[model samples]
Target chain A: MWTRIRDFDRMIQAMDLFNSRLGGVFENYQRPRLSAGTWGVTESGPRTNMYDTGENLEIRVEVPGIKKEDLSVKLQGNYLEIRGTRKAENPEGYTAHRVERGETSFTRSFTLPSEVDAGKVEASLKDGILTLILGKAEPAKPKQIVIS
Target chain B: MSERQDVTVREEALSERNRQIPTVAPLVDIVENENEILLFADMPGVDKNNISINIDNGRLALSGVREVKPVGAVIWEEFADVEYRRTFSVPQSIDVAKVNAELKEGVLLLHLPKAESAKPRQIEIKVG
Candidate 1:
C-alpha cells in the first residue's frame, strides 16, 4: 500500500509539471505582440482544417473580418496557397479600452498528398470561413489477367 | 424576487453547459465613448442563427456554436471542432434595454448604450 501511494504521488507530480508546461504554451499562443513589418507580411497565421473525401480533398481556413474581395487563392501543382488581409476600421469618436484585433495579413500554403484536378477546384467563403474543394485525379486501375 | 432568482439560476446552468463544450475564447476589441461602449469579437464559422448573447447580474455573456468540420476522413487538421464563448463584466451605467448586436462575416459587434443618468451634463452658469 505504501509503494502504491508513492507511485500515485509521483504520477500526480508528473501531471502537475505537464499542466504547467501546457499553460505556458497556451499563454504564448494567446498573447499578442507587435513586431516590425517584413515585406508586408503578418506574423500570425490562421488556423486551418483539411480533409480527404476519397474522391476529393477539402480545406477550410478561418479568417474573420476580411472581405471576400481581398482574398486570393492559387493552386500550383500539388500546392495550394491562400492569402488575405484584414483591414482595421475604428469609428472616429470612440476611445479604445482594449484592442486585441488589428489589421493583419497572412499567406498560408499547403502541399496536398494526392494529385488533384486543377480544373475542378471550387472555393467559397461564408461566415469568415474559406473552403476549398479539390477533386482528385482519376487513378489508373490495375489490369486483371486470366491464364489456363 | 423569486422569479428573478430563478432566472439567474437558469442562466448559471446554461453557462455551465457552455463550459462543458470545447470552447475557445475569441479575440475581442472593446471601445468606449461618452454615449456608448462597443465590443468587437472575432468568431469564425459562427453565424447569426447559432449565436447567443445575454446579460445577467452585470455579466455579459457571449456564446456560439461553430461547425468546422464535415463528414469525411480528416487527412490533416490544425484545429478541432470549436465552440466560442466569452464573458465580460458590464458596468451599471449601461442601459441594458438599449443594448444592440450585429453579426457580420463571423464577427460580432455589440453596442451597449449608457444610461441617461450616466451621460455627462453641463449645468448652466447663473449670472449674478
Candidate 2:
C-alpha cells in the first residue's frame, strides 16, 4: 500500500509539471497578432492538383468580401498574375461579440504549359469563387488518324 | 457504487447527445498532380449561380454567404448560421492564364496547372 501511494504521488507531480510547462508555452504564443505569411491564407507552394488535366485547365481562387471591379489579371510570358484588394469593415464602439473579418490585398500566379493557348484566357467570378478557363493550343489537342 | 454508476450514465448520455450536433462546415478535398491541382469544396445549400471567386495582389480569396431566412414561424431548427471564408497564396509557377473552375452538385472544383518546367520528362535508353 505504501509503494502504491508513492507511485500515485510521483505520477501526480509529473502531470503537474507537464501541465505548467504546456501552459507557459501556450501563453507565450501571442493571440490576435497579425500573421501575414501562411497563417492568414493557404500557402502558395505546389498544390496537389497541379497537373491533373491535359487539354483544359481550371483554376479557382478564394477571395472573400472583394468586389468584382477591384480584381485585375495580367499575363506575363507563361505566368498569369492576379491582383486585388479587399477592405474590411470595422464596427467599433459597441461591445464586439465575435469578429471574423479578414480584409486585405492578395495576389497569386500560375505558370501555364507550353501547349496552352495564352491568347484566349477567360475568367469569371460568381459569389466568392473565381474561375479561370484556359484552352489548350492545337498541338496539345489529340490527333486523329484516317483509316483506309 | 450506485451513485457513481448513475453519474457515469448521465455523462455518457450527455456526450452522446453532443455527438449528434452537426458541424457547420463541410469537407474540402485538395488534389495535386504533376500538371495541375484540383480543389473541391462542399457547400451545401449554397447556390452555384450566386457564387464568386477572386484572385488579386498575391492572394486568392474564397467567401460564401449562407442565408436561411426564417420560414413561417420556426417549425424545426438544426442549422447554425455561418459565413465561409478561406484564402490562399498563389505561387509564381502556375500558368494562371489557363486555369478553370466549375461548380456542380453543391461542390466547387478548381483546377490549377503547373508551368512546363515544373513537370517531369522521361529519358530514353541508348543501345550500344
Candidate 3:
C-alpha cells in the first residue's frame, strides 16, 4: 500500500509536468505552443491593436526585425491592409545553434468602425513597431447636437 | 511528504495567475565561434532604459519591459504591456568586462568574448 501511494504521487507530478509542457496549446490556433517571436502573435499575421478617437483612428502593430522597405500598407474607405516579409537575419558564415526569432511573411487586414480619409492617413515606424493615424472623413466625424 | 508536495504544487500555479503583467521569454538565437559567443534577442516596443542585463556566478539574466499607452477607446487589442524575462548559464571563462551589446530595430545583439586563457592555441613541435 505504501508503494502504491508513492506511485500515485509520482503520477501526479508527471501529469503536472505534461501539462506544463503543453502550455497554451489550445489557447489560440494561430499561435504556436512556443511563441513565434517575442510578440507571440499569430503565425499568419502580426499582433495588432486598434483605437478609435473622435477625430481619428490609431492602429499599432508589432513587427520586430522588419525593414521599412519590406513593409507595405493599403487603405480604402474603412478597410486597411498590411503586408510584410521578415527575411532571415542570420549573419553570413555564422553557424546557428538556436534560431527562434520569427522570420516569415504575413498579411493582416482590418475594417474601421467609421470611414477614414486615405489621403490624410499618417504612418510612422519606431523601434520595430508600426503606428498608423487615420483621419476620419468629415461625414464620419462625431458631432454634438444642442437642445433648443 | 505527499501533503507538503500538494501544497507546493498549488502555490506554483497560483503565483502566475496573480501577476499583473504577463511575463514571457524573448525569442533568441545563439551562435558561437573561435573568439566569442553571439546572442540575438527580439524585443519590440521596449525602450533602451527598460532593458537590464545581469551576470553573476556563471549565470546571465536578461529582462525588458514594454509599456503601451493608447488614447481614447480601444476597439480591439491583441497585444499590450508585457515583461520579457530569460536566463542562461554561461562559462566562467567569459570576459564579463569585455562583453559588448547593441540594439537595432528592436533586436538586441550581445557578444560574450572568451578570456585569453580560454581561447584555443596551436602548439609548435620541435625536433630534438
Candidate 4:
C-alpha cells in the first residue's frame, strides 16, 4: 500500500509540473507589451497543437516569419523538443512609426502520451507551420487461447 | 465627401458579408519610412492563393482563408477553423497604384509606396 501511494504521489507531481509548464507557454504570449520602449527582443514561444490519430501522433506549431533552415527538432526518449530563431530586419532609410514585431528565439518541449517509434518520425515546415508526425510503437499482443 | 461615403459603404458591405464567417484578427506590425509604409500580418495556415488584398478609397482590406486538412480521425484538437480579416485606414498620401504585396510562410507583407507629393524633397543651396 505504501509503495502504491508513493507512486501515485509521484505521478501527481509529474502532472503538476507539466501543467505549469504549459501554462507558462500560454502566459508568455498573453503578457502585455510595454509601450514606452523601442521594440525589444521578444521571447515568446510558438503556439502548438498536439493530437493523436491512433496510428500516429501529430504536432503542429505556428512559427510565422521563420525560415526552415533556422528550426531544429529532436526526440530524446519520450520528450520532443523544438527550437528556432527568427532574425529581425528593418528596411533601410525607414522611420518606424509603429513596431510590434521583434527578433525572437524560443525552445519548447513536450512529453509524449504513448510510446513512439523514434526512427519513423518525420517533420516538415509549410507556411510557417511546423508539422511532426510520429509513428506509434506497436503493443505486444497476447497469444490466442484454444478452447477444446 | 465622396471618399468618406465610399469608406462608409465599404465598411457596411464588409460587416454584412462577414457576419456569419468565423474569423480572427491577425497580429500585425505597421512601420512607416520616408518613402513607403510596410505592414506585416501573421496568418498561419494561409496559402498565397487564398489571400486577397484590396485598396479602395484609402482603406486597405486584407482577407485570408486557411483550410485545415486532417488525414485521419482527430483524437484531440487545439487549433480552430478560423479565417482572417483586417482593415486599415491608409493616409491619402499613399500611392495605391504602386503598392506591392507578398505572402510567405503564412505571413503577409504589404508595401505601400508614398506619392510624389508626400515624398521628401531636398532643396539645393546656392552660395553667391
Candidate 5:
C-alpha cells in the first residue's frame, strides 16, 4: 500500500512538473527550463552529491558521455560552477534507428556550505564521474579545543 | 516500414530488490548499418565488472549497479546507489555468438551482427 501511494505521489509530481513546463512554453521557449538539482527531471543537468569532511568538501557529479576536454570547473571563494557539453555521437555511414541522447550543454553552479581555499581545490574525472575536493579555509577547518 | 526490425526494449516490472535499490532505465541510442546494429547506453558510475549483458533465445538483458559512498557527513545528495536494468527483444537473425560489447567512460557499446544467412546476397544468372 505504501509503495502504491508512493507511486501515485510520484505520478502527481511528474504531472505537476509537466504542467508547469507546458504552462509557459511560449514565453520560456528561448530560455531553457533551468534546474540545478535532480529532484524531478532526467534530461537536465547531471545529478550531484556534496559531503563535508573535517578539512575538505567533496563533490561528485555524474557526467556520462562527457570527455575531459569538454568539461570545465570554476571556483571562487564559496561559489563553484560546472560547465559541460555532451556532443551527439552519430557514426558515419550508419542510419539512426533510435536517438535519445542529444547534444546538451549545461551550466550548474552552487553556493557551498562553507568557504574553500581556491588554491588547493582538486578535480578529477574518472569513468565519466567528476569529483571535486575543496579544501576548507583556515577558519572553517574543524579544530579540537584543549580541555581546562 | 518495419522491414529491418532490429530490437525492442521493454521495462521490467519492479520487485523486492528493485524497491530497495531504485531501478532506472538508462538512456540508449541505437544505430545500424548493413553489417550490424550498434547500441550505446549511458550508465555513469557503474563499473565494468558490475555490469552484465546476456543474450539468450533472441532476448538481450543488461544490468548494472552503481554505489555512491560519501566521505564523512552528507550535506545534500541528488543521486544515490541504484541499479540500471533493461531488456530487449532481439531478432533471431542476429548472430548471438559474434556479439561483442565494450564499456568506456560509463557508456556501454554493444554490437549485434546479423547471421550469414540473413545478410543480403546477389545472384548471377547465365544466359543459355
Candidate 6:
C-alpha cells in the first residue's frame, strides 16, 4: 500500500512537472515540435545532482548514443563549454519499423566562480558517462603559519 | 498521423495484462563531492553508441533513443512509446571540461569536478 501510494505520488508529480512550463526553456527553444520530416534532435542536459562543494564543484550529465571521442570540453577563464553531436544510423537497409530516437546536436556552457583555479582539470569517459576532476590551485589551498 | 500511431501503440501496451514497459527513461541521480560529482540513471535499452550530453550557457541537455523494431505483424506492442527528452540548468561552479560519462549494465554514470581553485582545502593546525 505504501509503495502504491508512493507510485501514485510520483505519477502526480510527473504529470505536474510535464504540464508546468516554469523551467522548460529548453523545450521551448531547443526542442522542435514533433511531426513528419521534422528532423528533430533528442534532448540531453543535466539529469540530476547539479551541486557544488566548498572545495570543488561537481556536475553530471546524461548522453546516451554519443561516443567519448566525439565529445570535447574547454575552459576559458571562468567559463566552461561542452560540445558534441550525435548522428543518425543508416536507415536505408531496414524499414526503421519504429524510430524512437531524436537526431539533435547540442552545445552548453557554464560560468565558473572566482574561486575556480581554471587549471589542473582532468576528465575521463567510461561506459558512455563522462567524469571530470579539477584539482585546487596552490594559492587556494589552506595554509598555516606561526604567530609571532 | 505518426503521433496518432504512437498513441495507438501506448493504448495497446495499456491493454496488456503485464505491461511494465517505460515510456520515459528512469530518473537520474547526481551526487556531488569535493572533487567530483556522480550521476546514475537507469536506461534499460540504451547503449553507448546512442547517448549524448551537452552543457552550454548554463543549460545542460541529455537525450537518447531505444529503437524497438516490430517483428512480423505486430501482434502486440510494449515499450518504445516516444523518443526520450530531458535537460537541466547546471550550476556555475562546475569545470565542464573535466567531465566524463560511462554506461554499464544499463546505467549511465557521469562525473564532473570543480576547477582547481574551486576545490576546498584543509587548513593545518599549529600548536606552538
Write down the C-alpha DockQ for each prediction.
0.30, 0.02, 0.41, 0.20, 0.29, 0.02
Clashes of each: 0, 55, 0, 0, 0, 43
Q: Across residues A34-134, which tens digit of lDDT does each residue of candidate 4 receive?
A: 22121112364676667777778888887888889999999987899999897775667667766666678989888887788889899988987889999
Candidate 2 stretches greater than 4 Å from native = A1-54, A91-96, A145-148, B1-45, B48-128
| Index of the highest-DockQ prediction | 3
- Residue B31 local lDDT, model 5: 93
Query: Tens-digit lDDT track for model 5 on A1-148?
Result: 3344545655655564553434323323433443421221146677788999989999999888888999999988798999998888899988998887667888889999998999889999876689999999999999999999
DockQ of 2: 0.02
What TM-score does candidate 2 get on C-alpha atoms?
Answer: 0.38
| Better by TM-score, candidate 4 or 2 | 4
After best superposition, candidate 6 residue A21: deviation in angstroms?
20
User: How do the residues B17-99 of candidate 1 rate in per-residue lDDT, one tens digit apiece?
Assistant: 22223455777889999999999998888878889999999999998877665747887665555567788999999999999
Q: Report, to 2 decimal places, the DockQ of model 4.
A: 0.20
Name the runs in model 6 displaced over 4 angstroms.
A1-49, A138-148, B1-128
RMSD value for candidate 1: 9.8
Task: Give candidate 4 misplaced runs (Cα > 4 Å).
Answer: A1-44, A140-148, B1-21, B125-128
The lowest-lDDT stretch of 10 consecutive residues in candidate 3 chain A is A20-29
**Which candidate would rank higher by TM-score, 2 or 3?**
3
Candidate 5 stretches with Cα past 4 Å from truth are A1-43, B1-19
Fnat, one value per model: 0.63, 0.00, 0.63, 0.51, 0.61, 0.02
Query: What TM-score would every model get versus the actual structure?
Result: 0.73, 0.38, 0.78, 0.70, 0.77, 0.39
C-alpha lDDT score of every prediction, in listed order: 0.76, 0.51, 0.78, 0.72, 0.78, 0.52
* lDDT per residue as tens, model 3, A10-124: 5655565443344323333354433533344347678888898889999999888888999999987788899988888777766888988747888888888899988889998
Name the better of 3 and 4 by TM-score: 3
Best by TM-score: 3
**Cα lDDT of model 5 by residue, B1-128, tens digit:** 56532233435334322224556677788998888999998888888888999998878999988888778999877777767777888988899999999887788899999999988889889998
Measured over all alpha carbons after superposition, the RMSD of each candidate to the real structure, in angstroms, is 9.8, 25.6, 7.2, 14.8, 11.5, 25.2
Q: State the weakest 10-residue window (summed lDDT) of model 3 chain B.
A: B10-19
Question: Chain A TM-scores, all candidates?
Answer: 0.66, 0.56, 0.73, 0.64, 0.71, 0.57
